[model samples]
Target: MTTRLNPYLGFKDNAREAMTFYQTVFGGELALSTFGEFQASEDPAEKEKIMHGMLTTDSGLVLMGADTPNSMSYTPGDNYSVSLSGEDEGELRGFWEKLSGSGTVTVPLERAPWGDTFGMCTDGFGVAWLVNIAGAQQQEAQP
Candidate 1:
């Protein structure tokens, strides 16, 4: 209903698995629809590929992703990483663990010189993510 900016990932053929994995880490409701669910595909193999999928977390995070149709060139890039920043250390840490479990951790989550816990990693599906836990001083309210 309102304007929102969120990550919409592109996968070669693993959109379902990747989205499901994200749901586990973010604790949310996931809705997925595939090409076959809507219309028959000329290519049998692609009929089941995801057309669109969305995950809305309890924390109000919304992430959408889909399998790149054969008609398009799905060039996976390292250009960006979905970032999560907040004062909730426990929640953010939990997400970091699950997200980096079967993936590569480019940066370990630890205290930073700027007084925050931060890390970056590429999920199993090749989607990058960054998580930051605000430090104690950051927990205070600001006018």
Candidate 2:
């Protein structure tokens, strides 16, 4: 396997639900492991919470996420952000809608100065995202 860069999200407590929703949106094989499965958490309440969750899409997208343990300090404003960029307008837009819904839109999706459609938002899990749709002329010019 070649080296790849992908987004790994961090959640307060809803890692499983967030990963499941992402699977529904991207259509992929989602492999998840809980704190109990790994014997990583001492708290019984956190046993079932996700320790690690990886979603590998058929489109070659890999997204990983985990629930933050209470033992550690977790602030909502920072940490992880995923950037989704490509020429697929319909697909990227669909993802933006699903990700931004019930969450906050830091930057509304719209046409950018680079001639591409772009937007930024933080998902319900507090994971930031950047979605970009390439320009039509750029596509046409590509041989």
Output the number of the TM-score-best candidate: 2
TM-score versus the correct structure, for each prediction: 0.52, 0.55
1-143: candidate 2 lDDT, tens digit per residue: 22234776789999999999999999999999888886777999899999778898888888888898888657776757676766766777889999999699987998765567778798998777877677884557669
lDDT of 1 by residue, 1-143 (tens): 32344676879899999999999998899999887886635677889898768899878899877887787566778333576766766678888999999799987998765567778788999888877677774546444
CA lDDT of every candidate:
0.77, 0.80
Would you give me the overall lDDT of model 2?
0.80
In model 1, what lDDT does residue 113 have?
53
Candidate 2: worst-modelled 10 consecutive residues by lDDT: 1-10
Candidate of highest lDDT: 2
Clashes of 1: 0
